[model samples]
Target chain A: MSLINIFSDYTLRTVALGSALLGAISGVIGTYTVLRKQSLVGDAVSHAALPGIGIAFLLTGSKNIEWLLLGAFISGWLSLYIVNSIIKNSKVKYDSALGMILSVFFGLGLVILTYIQKIPDSNQAGLEGFLFGQASTLLKRDVIVMSIVGGAIIIIIALLWKEFKLLSFDPEFCQVSGFPKEKLDLILTTLIVIAIVTGLQTVGVVLMSDMIIAPAVSARQWTDKLSVMVILSSIFGGLSGVIGTIISSSTRNLPTGPVIVVIISAISIISLFIAPGRGIIWRRMRDKKNKKRLNRNIILNSIYNLNIEGNRIQGYSLEDLSISKGDFNFPINTIEKELEKLETLDLVKGKDEKWYITEKGINEIEDFRGRLEE
Target chain B: MNVQIEIQLIAIVVALACSTLGVFLILRKMAMMADAIGHTILFGIVVAFFITHDLNSPLLIIGAALTGTLTVFLVESINKTKLVSEDSSIGLIFPLLFSIGVILISLYAGDVHLDTDAVLLGEIAFAPFNRFVVNGVDIGPSSLYIMGAILIMNIVYVSVFYKELKISTFDPNLAMALGISPGIMHYSLMTLVSLTAVGAFDAVGAILVVAFMVGPPTAAYLLTDDLKDMIFLSGIIGTISVVLGYWTARIFDVAIAGMMAVMVGAIFLLIFLFAPDRGLLSIMRRKKRQKYDFAQISFLMHVINHEGAKDEREELGINTIHEHLGWNKEFVKDIFNNLYKSNLVYIEDDIIRITDKGRDLAISNAEEIVNGI
Candidate 1:
């Protein structure tokens, strides 16, 4: 479907609007997620929500998104509670508790989901889709709720942005300075849960986890500053939602959830491999160029050394020293380039018979050898 | 009747595997990877099924386990690069794999009896239907056997390598200095986590695989300090959660596994507010007690410093008040035993006296408190 068609298409618009708002919230919340080093808290809390959703559905016999999502929100909060408790009570770290709560809650969720699947009375066929969200199911009204929640999340993030950043960097310092580190942490966690629960109604479960993580990953690659990371990640998230909608609408059988997921992953990969300082490919290219420059210098120095060895400073064939230089030279053209550079530097003389080292070249070669030995 | 019990046994076996693996994951702080592995295994399960053309074959688990291993590598490699953060790496990798799984399900496995979702998170209530048979006599659920095998492997692995795991977890750099490969230990831990997730998938699905892997350990951690104690407590907590959760579900007529998870969370919240030392109530209690003792000590020192008092007796009546120090009558009684035990004062029936030893000690303590030492 085209752009005009997308506007007219309720399903497409609903999912796009819902996901965009949700993305903004995750981005805003993810600032804290990345800063607090609790970035995986998204997946942890999301997984933590599962068993609760299953329990809610099982108890209520209702498919109402609110009740189920509330259950999820409680579960997510509970995971955070357990994480904090582990950190406080034992010597175990936050990541471990995070890991523990994440797996256990999700495992329990799965078990319940499987059990629910067998229950003849429950019509829970599409419940698994909630694991990886499907924004396509969102109605126009749901989009409105998502946008409101998204707006609120952004506002909350904006208000406590400094406190959150300060607290995340060093809670001890914040506490010493009389800032409420626990309160800030709670606010961040609460906002994250809100973003996640809002997304839950749209994207579902598993993909919701990715959406929370993906924008931050992309944003992190693009910027070092937290403010910039939050903004950039939100933009990527918004783009993924819009793009995912377009793809999902064009294809009949394709759903928006996986398409959105793929788009986000694509953005992450691009950022990972091609973004400025952090990009893998750029660094690799830089490393290769530096090595090439080093090889040229090595060749130039090798010729200068041969001339300074006190052998009449006469023509020495390239074949005479190729093995001695450890075969560092690449090709005939490369050798010619280095020799030309040496001549240009006025460090050598006698072009045709094999270059002779000038006094300047001799001194330089001796210095290079001395430095290498040292 | 027996079949239902066998099905429940399958879940418990998976829980056993998860708890064993969960402890290491908790120790390594990589417990959330169970969620990543659970979701990504969907792709491997689908791919394996397409290749083998049979969903129930052992190849599915093997292929999924392999992918789970690969997922660990992907996440770890990203972690090593120091480019992407840990959570972001996990959030990035698992979704892509899961998306691939979702796509495969849509394009190819949509019509299969065992679809991607089903295979990724099998039916716990129906696991008993897929029973093993030998010589025409029915054995227990195949899942029970699979999970049992995994649980045994994990128990043996953990039991044998507890010291190694403890060493590596607390200080990986130190472990490396002492001739241990932290990387090896880490990958081994992830492997156990992945194996647990895969084995549990047939009975508990992906999320519970995560829940079982993380919940018990976290709760246990909240209640204990020692690692050895944490593991044992976590195992007990896991089994208790399973049993209690099942009962709650039965009583409430709801989902058993979900109730179990909620129960785990419930127990955790209770312990969070009540456990000793770091617990909310305990910390408050300690603070209140410290303040009360501080006030009492201050009063006792004040009474001893009143040099003009000529009372020969050591007892301070309940009504006695050092009004010049602006003290209350009740505080003298409060400080009586405390000051006497420290030998800072001698109390008779109706008056109190500062002895030579008591006076000297009181002066030193008063100076320390006044100097803020």
Candidate 2:
């Protein structure tokens, strides 16, 4: 591809659209999944869809995407039901339930697929691709289906937005307040199952949840507002899809799904280091600046202690601590810098490199170390 | 019929192992770890295949188990950082590796028979076909043996370290204070889980592995409060559900693993709705009974207290009396009839009378009833 080819309707409307839709929806739903701590529910349910598709292929011997998808839906729903049952009935937390179902169902799928492979059957084409996915192979029809599913997800999420927000934030409260938590939970889960089943072919269950969660997670780092989070997540998701398909289509055997995940990971890394609030870079810088202030304050307080004892504080060496501590070379240098800073403020005086605390420095030190009170 | 029997045998062992691992996984809140690890093991398997050049080689299990268990370490390590939350870290790691595994298997080892599809959904019917035999006399399934050895190993490990596992799982801080390294315990658990998944992978693959791990333990968890009981119940539930799921697969002509998982779900739902004390229906039944008994006694007490006449008024107010009783009005009439027939009360134009026995019982044992003693 040339640039013109890349932008052409043929390339833009088929693979790009499907991946983008799948990625964006995953991004949106993934936010809640991540925050509510049900992120693996996506992966688990998606994996669960495998056996359903396999069995469908076995029984129907028909390669209709719809039939396979119906199988995917049943199995996916069944997996979710199992997870819910585990969570509701047992002391096993939701994460464990999600994990358990994810492995067992996918394991069962593998067992089935292995058997299918041995039986000399050709009906399981594209079933294995669902373990990951090939976005480059996504068709215009697949794009249409994905977009419709994505649209339905958006609308349902909108309708249940309030209840979902409440339930996600405080399910116990939702239950105590009588907001039909069980039905709401069921509906929310159903929507997720539907989404997983729909995406089984188009995105493959393997990379889909990462597509869903990565954008939302990266978006969360960029913004505190929910709407902004959703919008940013969708954009990141769509952007990842577009970029992932381009990269994969450029090289044969390059997977669209994992590449999509890698792109999202890059964005998340950027936001984690550079975004405000909890961003690493911001905190590092803030800590550095705070350290300078702390050093100055500590040195000034030490000088004030000498003054309170009515000593000249002129014969002091820098090495001093009530407890065993690190070496004094760095501390001495830190003290010199603070002394200079205090001198500029007229809070300290130096005679031949021996420093004494002025009244102002004493007062400042007293203020920095607040009065102890009961 | 023979295939179904063999599948059931495999499923039972697999379910037992999965459920055994699941009890710990759920307790540790790392259920998705099993799922993520299962998929990621494809990469390990393929890598092992490259090195060992045999899909069935023990090296594959070693490499795959190492990778699966390390996947846990990776998830936890990533989670410790601020960049990715716990779930996000989990979501990110496995699929990337899994996708790599899938793509590589397709490109590098397409003919190796251990592709992504085989890792996701496996057939239990074919499990028996891959036999480990000595001198042409078949001794059932090879996978069954692996699962059995693992089940015994895990049962022994869990049994020997039951208190430690419980302590670490329930309160790691306390466990640490008591000289147990919670991290080590967790790692051991992860190792066991990965080991179990790899063994089961040969027989049932990943999806059913998760179902077996999660379903029975959860059902059992709901039915019992005791840890030992929960373990036994979960094992029983896992075995029963596998048989039932395999049976359903036969009846419906559907996939065995899928049917098995659905069967587990059905059992869980059944337990959810009707498991004697913990089921929703049981809870409802208990509530109904409580309401009935409360109303019966309250009506009996009302008759006793109002036998002559209310000190403040000629007739007792039902609302006032109910307010004092704090019971639903719906049960009052039914309780009144039962009281009347039992001679606990006789109503003459609603001026109720409490027999002497009713008065004595109400006064003497009111506190005991309130306390449910």
Candidate 3:
């Protein structure tokens, strides 16, 4: 089927739009988490949201999405607060505290969920979806709620962009500037909680961290500027959502959460390998060039030292240099290759099987030595 | 034995093992890696099943080990890039592996007994049903034995390598300088963590495995400063949590694993508030006590100075004491009451007199203050 046909489908469109909104906001909010080195904080808060959801259902006696989400928001916020408190008040480190809150809250949530399931008249048919996500079962009303919540989160993030940037980049500077750092941190965390809770239904608890991390990681490979990274990350996140929805919709019995995770992971893997400057491929190429230049200089230095020792620059072979500069560990082929480059650069002359360093090579070596000293 | 007894035994063993290993993880600042390994073991099981076409293959352990190492390697590799921090690297790798397992389950074997739900919410109550029978004799619960052996392995590993583990955990550079390979120790520990996590997860589930790994050790951390004491205390704390958790589960008839996790958290909570020196209440109490002690000493010094002064009008009366000390009436009264109870002061009517002990304390405090100690 054509792309138009897929977008035209009502259920698919709603699911796609909902997930896209979730992805974009999480991606944007996730930048702060990634930059501030609180990436696992997202993971912790999302897991902590589970119990809040279960408790909300038990207390309300209804599985209303709004009440459930409210419960998750409160739970996530409380977990963040607990993590902060543990770090501040005790000797426990940050990661352990995050892990402690995450696992405990999730365990409590499980207990509550099991308890709710045992109740006779409970309408908990879809509550378990929050564990691994059941985006395929999303209703139009659910999509509407997600859009509203996610939209508000993104708008708030946009409004507080400068403060968020300053907070993420230099919290000490923010404090020195008397910027209400604690309040800003609370606001940022609350926004992350809202984003996590909203996305919980679509991607579930286990895969939600991927939704937050993958887009930001992918965008980071392509840019250094925070503004550009933010824009790119959101686009990557939104694109992954749309792509994952389309693929899952076309496939039979495929869930959306894992599919979305897979799609975003692919985007990040590609970005890691092939993006400019920061990419593995580009970096490797630059490293290779630098190594070659260093090798050429080393060979020239070896020849210069040999010339000074015996004034014999005409009959140097690869074996001679290899034995004299054994620390270089240069193989025969590598020595020959560097020598060939030096010959091409008119810094060396080769005749028969021996290589001679020209006056240009001597001058080049002197210039390199002078620059090294300075 | 009954399933309840079997589950309790399994819980104790798993908790002991996880909490023991957790001390190193916490010290190494890699506690979240336990959470990552717990989730990614599902991928290991899935791939093992796919490769062997047998869900119960023992080779699943190898797959688990491979993927667990992969997780550690990936997190370290990402962190080495300096693009992301250690926690971000953990966050980056965990979900990707777990999601792949989910995708595999959904695409190929959703109909089979291989389940994500089972992985997430393992049933300790049903552990006895999956018993190991040898030669027509039931060898009790398989989870019990598996977890028991794992518990022993963890004990042996930590004991045999205690010095190495301690050196590496506390100061890797020192370990390296002393000819110990911190890298090798690290990978070995990660391997052990993966093995213990998978075995424990099969009995108590992933979330509870994390709780046991982190919660008890953290509580122990808050309670002590010595490494050996931390390990010993974590085991004791974990055992206490399991015993209490088992009773709570029975009383409520809730999920045993979840209840155990909650109980572990509760124990940590209590310790966080009441662990003598490092706890919240104790710290606050110490601060308050320090303030009161400082005030009492200052009052003693003031009285000594007043008596030494040439002005006879500076008498040691309650009203004068309050005014001279700049303390409120209630605070002054409390200080005076404490001083009199300790015999550091003699009170006759409205006048206060410093005792010999009080004079000595004031002189020593003056010495300390003058020396700027």
Candidate 4:
């Protein structure tokens, strides 16, 4: 099918737009989560939201998105509050509290879900889908609501960018400067809660954390500034949404949330390996070049040191140097390779089976030695 | 044995193993790793099934354990990049791997009995029916044997390495200096955690593994400071929750694993609110008592400081005392009345008088506070 035909499908279009908005908003707000090292808290809150959604359905006997999301937001916030209290008041660490809350809430949600499934005429078919999300089954109205929610989250993040940035980079400074650090932290967490609640429909609880982390990490590879990173992350997140939607729609039985997660992870893995200075591949390449230069300098300095008394010893063989420089213990082939490189740089020349230092090599070695002595 | 009894036995064993292993995980701050390993084991099972083509193969357990360790290795590698925090690295790897497993099941194994729902929340009721028979004779349920072995393994692992684990968990640098290899202990403990997690998977499913692993230990942690006591208490708490959870599930006709997990949280909540030293109620009561003590002492000091002053203007009456201390009238009256009843002060009509007991109490209290400082 053509792009036009794909976009013409109502369900596909709704899912694509809904997930796109979800991704963008998650990426934008999740930058703080990633920076503040609260990425897994998103996972906890999302899982914790499940029971609340189930309870909301049981009480209202409806599948209304707004009511379910409201329930999710309240419970998600409650779980976070519990986590904060646990960390502050006890010897339990942060991750343990997060893990404890996550599992207990999700288990409670499972009980509620199983109970709700048994209730007659409950319309709870779609409730289980929240575990892994079912964006492909989203309706146009749901999409509209998600977009509005996503838009509001984006606006809040934008309006408080400076404060959030200050808080992320130097929270102590922000607090010392008389900023309401606690209130700002609450606002940031609430925004994260909003993002997770909104994205719950698209990615589900189990996979929602990836939507927050992958894009922010991928964006972090390409920039140092917070603003640039946030923008790039949102773009990457939105792109993954489009790609995942297209793939899931194309393939039967492939879920949208996991597919989106796979696509975003691919993007992140690619960015981690090949993106400019920060990428692992580039760092490896830079290290290789620096090591090669270091090898050449060591071999050249060793040759200079061998004839320190101005008794010019010409054409020192690779074996002689390897033996004399037992501390470096460089192999014969390694010495030969460095010698070849020195010859190419015109610092040394080879004549019949021996290496001779050129006039330029003498001056360069003297200059390095003078600097070292100084 | 009755299937219900057998199932409850498996739950007890599973809880014992998970709670014991969970103490170490929580101490190492790797509590969330239960969640990570829990989900990643699905990928391991799927891959093992793909390779061996047998869901019942013992290799699946090893495969799951290996993949659980692999998950740890990958999370560490990503963390070493310094590009993302440890939590983000965990967030990054598991979903992608878990998604692959879910997608694989949906695409190819849909017709099989391998339901994602079953993986998340195992059917403990049917666990007994999936029994292990030896040479035409009936043994107990397969889960009972599996969980029994894991429980034994956890017991032995903890006992054998109790000192090393304690030293490493408390101080890795010291362990390293002593050549104890905290890294080896960590990986081995994680492997044990993965093994316990998989053994309990067929009984309590994945997510509740975390609840069992974290909840009981945390409850025990609130009650005791000794590591050995914490382990024993956690085991006791886990067993209680499983028994209570089984009865509740039977009564309510709900998911057994879910009820057990809920029970774990409920027990933790009870301990959190009522434990002797660290419970929330105890903490709040201490604060309340301290506030009362502070108020009483300050009130006594005020009355004593003003009594028999050379300047008549400095004299304090019952009405003037409340204004000077900036306390409410009722509160001041309550304090004054209590002091009067105790013979700490005698309110002579309008002016307050300090008795000998009050002076001795104030002087001794001040000296005690000074010595404390």
Per-candidate interface DockQ score: 0.36, 0.32, 0.71, 0.73
Which residue pairs collide in model 3, if any? none
lDDT of 4: 0.86
Candidate 3: list runs displaced more than 4 Å.
A300-336, A346-370, B52-56, B297-363, B366-373
Q: What TM-score would each prediction reach against the true structure?
A: 0.81, 0.81, 0.89, 0.92
Fnat of candidate 2, please? 0.51
Give one digit per residue, the lDDT tens place, for model 1 in B299-332: 6666665545554222233344545446665665
Best-fitting candidate, scored by TM-score: 4
Can you tell me the DockQ of model 3?
Answer: 0.71
User: RMSD, each candidate, Å?
Assistant: 5.6, 5.3, 3.7, 3.1
Rank by DockQ, descending?
4, 3, 1, 2
Clashes of each: 34, 38, 0, 0
lDDT of 2 by residue, B181-268 (tens): 9988989988888888887876666656777777787778778878888888888998887887777667656567777776776777
Candidate 4 lDDT by residue in tens digits, A67-101: 99999998999999998988787777888888888
Q: Please say which candidate is ahead in DockQ: 1 or 2.
A: 1
Docking class of 2: acceptable
Estimate, for each residue in B1-373, the C-alpha lDDT of model 3 and write its tens digit: 7667777888899999998899999999888999999899888877887777754445776677678888999989988876666777788788888988888887886555677888777887877777788999998877778788888999999999999999999999999999999999999999989888888767788667899999899999998889999999999999998888888888887888888889989999999998778889999999999898889898888777776455424567767778777779899889888888988988666567789999998899878878996
**Per-residue lDDT for A3-94 in model 2, tens only?**
35566759555877787787788778776776777776777788778788888888988767677778888999998887676556545577
| Candidate number with the higher TM-score (2 or 3) | 3
How good is the docking of model 3, by CAPRI class? medium
Task: Indicate whether candidate 2 or candidate 4 has the larger TM-score.
Answer: 4
Task: Give the C-alpha miss distance for residue A265 in model 4, angstroms.
Answer: 1.4
Model 4: pairs clashing at backbone N, Cα or C within 3 Å: none
Which structure is stronger by lDDT: 2 or 4? 4
